[model samples]
Target: MVHLIKTQSSSAKSRMGPASLNPDLPAVAGLGSFEKLNGFFNAIYDGPTEDPPWHSALNLLCETLHAKHVTLILKPPSPVSTGILVNTDAVAHDATEAYQNHFFTLDPFVGLPEGQVVTPEELVGDKVWKQSTLYREYLKPLDVKFLIGADIQTADGIECRFRVSRGGDIPFSADDIALCRLLLPHMRRALQLHSRLDGLETERQLFAGAVNSMQLGTISLAHNGAVIDLNPEARRILAEKDGIQISNNVLCTDNRREGHELQRLIKEALSGSAGKKGPGLVEALALTRPSGRSSLGILVKEIPPSPWTVNRQRAAAVIFIRDPEASVAETSQKIVQQLFGLTRIEAAMALSLANGSTIEETAENLGLKKNTARTYLRFIFNKTGVTRQTMLVRKLLGSVASLG
Candidate 1:
């Protein structure tokens, strides 16, 4: 017959103090109990923004509960998935590795009723638990004598497991369970916030990567025309100090006439009066480079103010700059070649022409005769279904080659 540890029911346990179960547990440090709780709650709320989210809160919980290990299974392990696991510093690397690799399936303490805290002995009879493979081979060797755990289910369908382990005879007290129960709701909310923030950050990185891959210079400006943010390509272009540069934290051109025009366009975009055509109008200009390279193409467009940000000096305008002299990425060239099934020479010629180079210039660059370049260009036109050089440039620019 299985022997079970007769513990008090949930109602009776809620009334007991921490000293009732474990009198040797350490006392709080200099701060009062209220202050410590306040700090823990703060850490919990601050977790989503932290680099390694919840590290501080988990460590504090381990200390507060006097637990040998505090493990948070953000995602539970399954037959097909290894899942996500986080542990406090008290957990050794080998113990964690072993549990994740082989013993997770055998753990009988998991899948506890959502938000209901229970010790292993309470969940499974003491005699049955001691005889189990997980107990004898995993917990016993690690000196884990007692454990308290609960499963947290978020509204977004995330199942999280919170576990606290103790090595000695002292089991978790009723006060410890009460504290965990109180914090469970907050933990659920924090995890939901973290999931949403993580998704947004991932999407931002994806779009930023696509823009950077295209070598497109993007500059975000505040309502007052101050430079708020810029992608890597914009930073590179400004760093060269060629035609466009940032002066007084605002975008400006080196040429006096072009500089005034650029400033006017930015002002128009910010003031919702592009040439008095009203808001949402786009303006374009070309800045002549001092280096005698091809002029830099610029487009300015107004950013509509959101309902909640009507009064804020947020990003009011965006400037898109493109350098005609910039060559397409080598990977993009390969993609273009594959997409059109063009010969290597033909593909190189197409990319050169797309970059605003003339057929004669491309011929000279590729060591091919002007007639041969024209022949290759004709072949490209036929294969790509474009009749004109301008059409071919539009086709290549609109293709997925830029995403390469």
Candidate 2:
């Protein structure tokens, strides 16, 4: 299934890498700079997006060394390409995204000869660098000159190799390669931190998704008693202070006593106890939205972790809201079928309406013709004696919405 067809490209002709690990290179890098770079990497690695701000670090390295520009080229996940990880102090800023998105897609720099030590004389001398397509599209406009690099074994994956580049007209000296060897530790640690931060962000999003998928009123409160997150059910109970702020541990008059109990339960769970996870004497919280109303019970549990991944010792608590009252589905059926005596299909249409779906959406989902859906709406109106969707929803919700 794998093929290695040779291409008559300039990079193919040059095929450069280190000749050998330099003897004078420091065995270990400085620890203080490594920690600082690690911290920066962690901050961005936890971002919601895949691309981290590694270019900034490369810029710092460039500034410190008085280099014109520095680029960190990461070998692609596949052997077919080279991806630019960081292009700091770039010359062709306009083409930066293009290089990252497309140029690197074909750059022959990735599949360069591995294992043996290489030098510029091996990869590109005078003629080959001028003819390479990647240099023309990415490096030419940027005025890139001298290029020195090292291929590192990536910690996570095989196809991934690390290379740092200093761009200029002058050729790199042996001392320059030694300098890079000195800085390799910082680069490796930075990448590892980025990997960990990415894991944390993914965990957060997964937790959020789990919270939303539950048929419960859930709220995540920060350590300082301020609410940081809320699902639909919990939002209503918190009364969403300022139309956005909501908390599980809210100090509202309606659920003050209950919120206090929930907070105590969280405290217990954080203090190495499971808290009252059983069906205890806690009362369900009332939810009143404009569409439907229901009651929600609460449960708290710890986020799962392996032995080494114990970052959340006293971090956020996972709140589970269980609707004791009828769910949104049940509420919609109760309102549309019981009150209006509509057929199950017609009741489903009305139920979908209650969930904020437009008529077209409801009809498409049920595989019913739009006109037929309209007819059912008419019948619902005639039976319930309500002229509009808003009125129907209001009648069911009764100032309290179901968390369904």
Best by lDDT: 1
lDDT by residue (tens digit), candidate 1, 124-199: 8888888989989998888988888889988888899999888888877766776776678889899999889989
Encode model 2's per-residue lDDT on 1-404: one tens digit a residue: 11222332455233322211322322222222345444434533432233545655566556544566666555453345435455565435666567666776555555444432234446666576667777776766666655555565546753334444456555555444544554555556555665566689899777665445444556564444444566665665445342122335443323456556666666654453553455354333332333344534556654434567645333455565555443353453544466567788877887788777789999999999999999988988887678999987665554222322
Candidate 1 lands at a TM-score of: 0.76
- Give the local distance difference test score of model 2: 0.54
**TM-score, per-candidate, Cα-based:** 0.76, 0.56
The C-alpha stretches of model 1 lying farther than 4 A from their native spots are 1-35, 78-81, 92-98, 139-142, 222-228, 245-277, 309-317, 330-379
Error of 1 at 91 (Å): 3.7
Worst-scoring 10-residue span by lDDT in model 2: 16-25
